[model samples]
Target: MSTPTSTDLVVGARPDHLISPHGVLDLRGSAGRDVWLSYPFDAAVVVCGLPGSGKSTLLRAWAASATVVDPRVTRTSFEARMPAWLPYASYRPWARLRHMHWLRGELRRGGPLLIHDCGSRSWMRGWLARTARRAGRPLHMVVLDVGAPEALSGQQARRRLASRRVFALHRRGLARFLRQVERGGQAQVPGISSVVVFDRGQRDRITAVRFGSRPS
Candidate 1:
């Protein structure tokens, strides 16, 4: 929704790499064009992290070749132009409302959807999974493993700090979710075809997001 800031940009990004190979789905009468379709991913891809865990940076890198649905982009844009007197809390609801509306529209249109999540709220995780499933698209999760101190430092660098309480809530939820993932708890999140884990270093190495590149 908003332009990616110079600092909040990924250096490199790439297409989603398939972990489990399978037959392609939903081809509209193409005789021998399999190579041209379903090369990247057929489901929604979500990148999750805490407030300052670099989700926006990654999205910016991916934006060039992918559809990245991020709420912070809009939020930041609004804050940039708003009067200093108006607290973000006053308009926070509207920002969230706009994000939800945009997300719905994007999903409806549907094709290689990419999302940025903060690993909070079980309801949202389930909802996204369900939506992708209903649309016959696989949902993949890219979780960033960042420590609290590091994330907080990132916030300081950005000149924005998330409320302690809110950040704590997100951290707790993320911890539990990550635990499940480590234990091979696939059932924890339904409709997830694969989970790609990334750390700060790995994320920094990304530069682009392509949608039709199959892995060899």
Candidate 2:
């Protein structure tokens, strides 16, 4: 099979209005008792989770209801700064900082409206929230938590089957990714109001998480 294009990797788009196969579940209502909906149209939503936690799948589903933001139309740059040998390691602190800078600049210019596919580490999330607050914008996060063991196994399996050298690098990256998630779990980040946990079942099916006011 040919390499997937950026468009192909882009599972879903941010719509003018929110849409999901599960119907329009009001995010504000689910966020928390204290959570408030600022501007429905201009909020920055970050969907984060471990590898194979269905973050992409969920995003794709959500994209159906949203007016997908075209990357070409925005002045945004999607930088996967993870090292070839360990993409997730290189991605964690440094790449996140770089993205933060880019995000800030974009926000000043009315934002490029980014959707990061990487895991949302505590530091990264904190930095992003700070940046958004500074810009007078609300940062909405959708945390998709899939346990580390399953995610790592999925990564390893995928890497083993991939036909490219890049896949080998991704395998190393997965190792680093597992480390990051483990660390992030220990150091929980604040300011996150929404969390979605997905447990993987047979055939890549996800057992939906029972989200409550606080992280479970």
Candidate 3:
């Protein structure tokens, strides 16, 4: 496995695929916490959070088994193809379109997929929901609820930044989804079987992402 970057602030999540004590906020069998005794194992999970919100870092450490659909790969590729002097702001739209095109193709694949969500739009989730329904697969979520300031910290740590307007848009959309969850849309949401919310502390505690009978 590749060494995790210094930007990965998570503790106990090492290069090895082992979960250290500092990685899990709730111990197995802890009360009032959702403990995974069994999971579908074949379901796709869409991970949602604001840009620079540590989704990429966390998944880089944990999601070894699943196919990851992260925008960073595309963004990096786009940057490499662009002139060094041209700012990212100049080709943001082209980058987003290309990423979405890739995502749509990935969504057509079978079995388990791990999607890295940037939280700016809901169409992809809706499409995944519909696809899962048709394929008899379920959609699960591992959503990060990091505050705006911490998200900014994460952005700085990664040396990548999102515009304030885009950040505010993501914040609003994710909040709306969380509110819908509060209204008990956990199951009502399209093809979503389970939802897991993690704050910065809880996120740091996450050692790995597994889909079988236990946490990997």
lDDT scores of the candidates, listed in order: 0.64, 0.40, 0.64
lDDT of 1 by residue, 16-104 (tens): 33222121111112122112112245556787888888887777767666678888777987799889899999999888888877887
TM, every model: 0.72, 0.43, 0.72
For residues 1-216, what per-residue lDDT tens digits would candidate 2 score against the true structure?
121111111112222222211211112212211211122344556655555445555555445333333221222232433335654534446544555565667554442133444443445567766766777654544444445565556567655332345444544553454444335531333443222222343213322211112113
- Score candidate 2 by TM-score against the native: 0.43
Clashing pairs in 3: 23-205
Off by over 4 Å in 1: 1-41, 76-84, 213-216
Candidate 1 residue 124 C-alpha distance from true site, Å: 1.0
Global CA lDDT of candidate 3, please?
0.64
The local lDDT score (0 to 100) that residue 23 gets in candidate 3 is 12
